[model samples]
Target chain A: MTPLLECRSVTKRFGGLAAVDDVSCVVEEGSVTAVIGPNGAGKTTFFNCVSSIYPATSGEVRFEGVDVTRLAPHVVTRLGIARTFQNIRLFRGMSALENVITARHCRTKAGVVASLLRLPSQRREEAESEAIARELLAFVGVAKWADSAAGSLPYGDQRRLEIARALATEPSLLLLDEPAAGMNPRESQDLVELIRRISKRGLTVLLIEHHMKVVMGISTHIVVLDHGVKIADGTPEAVRNDSKVIEAYLGKEDVT
Target chain B: MRDRIVRLLVATLAAFLLALPVASLRGNSSTGFTIVWTPAFVTAAMVLVGGAILFAAVEAQRRGTAFWDARAATDSAVGRRRPCAAQAWTLGVLVATVAALPLLGLPGAWTKLLLETMVFATIAVGLQITIGMAGLLVLGHAAFWAVGAYTFGLLTVHQGWNFWIAFPAAGVAAALTGLVIGLPALRLRGDYLAVVTLGFGEAVRWVIKNEQDVTGGDANLPGNIVPGSFRKPMGALGEWLWQPAAVDGRTFEPGTVQALIDRECYWFALVLLVVCVACVHLLAKSRVGRALFALREDETAAKCMGIDTTRVKLVAFMASALWAGLAGVVPAVHRGSINPEMFDFNTSVLFVAMVVLGGLGSITGSIVGAALLWMLPALLANWFPEVQEYRYLFFGALMAAMMVVRPEGLFGGARRKGAA
Candidate 1:
């Protein structure tokens, strides 16, 4: 079968600097793929290109065999790819439940007239969206903060809320950027368990993380990048033991 | 305890001093400055000072907390609860009272004022969609209002279309204008969008002012476009139910007919206000509203949630402009005239001020804001002509004070903690 997501020599440039340069990778269906890199490794930039937040300056991105390189960010999302930011970007003023319910935008269809009229169909869709949002919030373990403002939630809860919001879009491919960045070990462990649970539900996850425990703990496959170039791709155990991956993380061995 | 007493006394004294209108700056060079305390000023000062002292004493005895602190607490509490039956009842009672006003022998001038207030209220509520909900700062909203009025004026007066036909057409015209402007303007965000909208507003007004023959330019619309007494149509409708033969022979006096027409117009405006408010309230609670709120909060996040930000923003713009257009028809039909000057930048600012003062995104707040900002000035002018000279100054001071005291607005719910 074709890979769930394939990037064929994708590149993104800002001015003269190539942030993500000619990097190609594949995310297999139902695999928990972790993209690991040191700081300035262009992991986030690659994610942006794939999600169409910043369209790649060169090459292509295909989801399930269809090219989506030129699609708008929203269209990319609608086509079953949802992502969380490196920094939490919830609808700050909205309630947690509202944040998740808002992600139901693509799944539901109700226009101005139907809304204004309070038609039965609109009401049914609204009820369904709310129910699904609540369920997602519970699944992420932040159900208690459903009515609290998303911005006011505790840090760990906010991360979980963002994950819930992404999941509310009902995406087949989930992109989690630095999900464990600010998390404590206990929280990151819980996130690993959550990822396992998510993958068990048959959804593929493509995460960019620096936390070795998280990347090695839950990811089935790992892709390593350093200075915008991919150096290793394989099962997590193989990538972890690779000499180049070791060199990229701990600097090159001196040839004295 | 002594310090508190001293503070209270000093506050009362300051209130008295501020209320005293003793100083004046004359425009003429010969008589530059003068201090004259008229008896009216003295009485006004005394009454104001007494009221302030009484209020302070009562407040000190009752809650002991600052007024605004208590108010904020209650506002948050109310905001948390979902809209319940009690709110619907309150709305019902308020509507009933307003509907009963003209029939209970409300004066003609007051009826007209209430009618005008309803028009502004509708516009302010509509504006909430863009500025309050979608977070689009459209400074040129009055351009849509102008489009609605002109469309109705041109169609009814020039083309001889029926009032009913022209009215809906006016709304459609404004919505089309909204779509045209939104297509380009929505691409720009925040302050840039605001400037573009402001320019669009001025451009529309200038077009109306310059297109002399078509719009009558600086002059008002051609022909007496105002409907001659809403009475005839109302009376004909009443006749269908219960018309007394004895009353028919009398051919009701012109004054009585005019009063009836005024009452009918007032009811019509009231109904429109109710419909607009209900529609907006419903829209705010719906899925589209969620998308709008999401868009307002964060465009990138909203897009990641699969929301088409551009399309949602356009929906908000068109919805708001549609209401403004519908509201634009009321004055043209009831007052019987349309002028480009009527829909100028000042009117747009006033509508925006009403929305802000009432609290962004608050439906009832919009109506209250419109009534306070629109009616208060007119009422003050009638009751205290001397204060009329300082109307704009008073308005500016009130707005500044409101910002300092309650930046979220009187009815605005407390925003999330740390939100900019």
Candidate 2:
């Protein structure tokens, strides 16, 4: 079967530096794939390329067998690839539910005239969007914050709210960048369970995380990178034992 | 009880201090400003200070605490789903008051001021869509207003079109102009976009000013004779429905007929204000409104959430321009002539100030802001002619004070909160 996402030698260059250099990977359907690396390992850059935030300099990114390399970020989202930011980027002034409802913008079809007139079709769509947003908020365990401003929510809840917002797009593949960065052990554990629940629902997830426990605990596949280059790709156990992965994480073993 | 008395005393003193500028007069060269101390000034000061103290005491008694403590107010009303009945009642009362003003035998000058205020209110509400909702600081809004006015002026004077046809044509013309400007300017953000729009506004005025024969340039449009075609006469249907006893038997007195016509015009403007307010209120609660709010908060997140930012911004621009265009018709018809100077950068800035003073995203705030800013100077001029030169200085001070005291504005309801 074809993979859900395929990146062929994607290279993103900024001036003279290659943030993501000639890296290729495939994300299979119905699997939680984790991209792990130390600080400045280009994990977030790789995700940006796939989401079309930057668009790879010399590569093709295929989503569900369609080339979406040059598509706008919003178009990429509409094509069933949604992503969260490394630093939580919620609509700070808007209510939590409004943030999710905004994410359902592409899914709803009401234009200015319909909205202005408050046509029956538009009203129905609005109601449906709200219902979906509320349900997603509950699923991500931030239901109580649905009415609060997204900015005022606690850090972990903010992370979960971002996930709920991404899921609102009804994406086939959800990309989370550093979701557990500021989360505590208990929060990361809860996040692990959340990812499992998401995967169980048949949606593929592509995540960039530094927390080894959460990464090893939930991801079915692992891709390791260091210095903008992919060094290992396999199951969690295989990647855990790879010498290159170990050397990248810990400085090279010195022999005197 | 002691604290309440102390608070009232402090508030009264503060009110007295704040009223000093308005109660005093400036002297030439040698002597600085001096307190007027006239019977009228003293009486006014007494009334103001007394009113402030009375209000504080009453409010404190009712709320059972310091009236200044806003946190004591319940949050149940903040994000409630129901439409606020108090707001509706306030709006109804205000509209009825304005509608009755002309019929109650208001002087011609006051009627004209009221009519002008309503026109500015409509324009301010329209600008709210671009500046408040979409968070695009459009400094050239008057250009769209000018476009609308010129469209109406040209169509009626040159093309000889009926008022009904020209009105909508004016709106469409302005909307088209908005689209043209929005296409290139929407690519810029914040201050750069503001400067570009400002330039566009000036460019439009220059074009109208230089076009001489076409627009009458600086002299005003329909230069020779103010066309009677622009005046929307109460049709046969209107005359048949209600013929006043004063005009029923005798030949029409020009003054009586003019007053009746002005009343009709006032009602027409009031109706337009209602429609503009309702449309904006509805739009604010819609999907496009949510997208605008999201865009204002964060563009990248909004884009990632699948919003077409450019399209949304353009929609706001066109919508706002459409209203300004529609509002442009009123001035053209009311004045019976259009001048490029009427829609200059100063007018644009005035509209911007109205939006900002009223509260960025508040619909009612825009109307209130427009009414206060437009009418206050005129009212002051009528009551205290001696302070004429200080009018804009007072306005500048009032706006600066408002910014410091309540940047969110008098009726800003943009910030949402959970039950606290």
Tell me each candidate's TM-score. Answer: 0.86, 0.86
Q: In candidate 1, which residue ranges exceed 4 Å CA deviation? A: B1-82, B223-233, B236-257, B416-420
Q: List CA RMSD, all candidates.
A: 8.1, 7.2
Give model 1's docking category. medium
The CA lDDT at A56 in model 1 is 96
Give residue B78's error in model 1 in angstroms. Answer: 11
lDDT of 2: 0.78
Q: Model 2, range B311-343, lDDT digits (tens) per residue?
A: 999989999999999998777766656778988
Name the weakest run of 10 consecutive residues (lDDT summed) in model 1 chain B.
B21-30
- Against the native chain B, each candidate's TM-score is 0.76, 0.76
On the 0 to 100 scale, the lDDT of residue A176 in model 2 is 94
Relative to the unseen true structure, what is the C-alpha lDDT of residue B142 in candidate 2, on a scale of 0 to 100?
Answer: 96
Model 2 alpha-carbon miss at residue B43, Å: 23
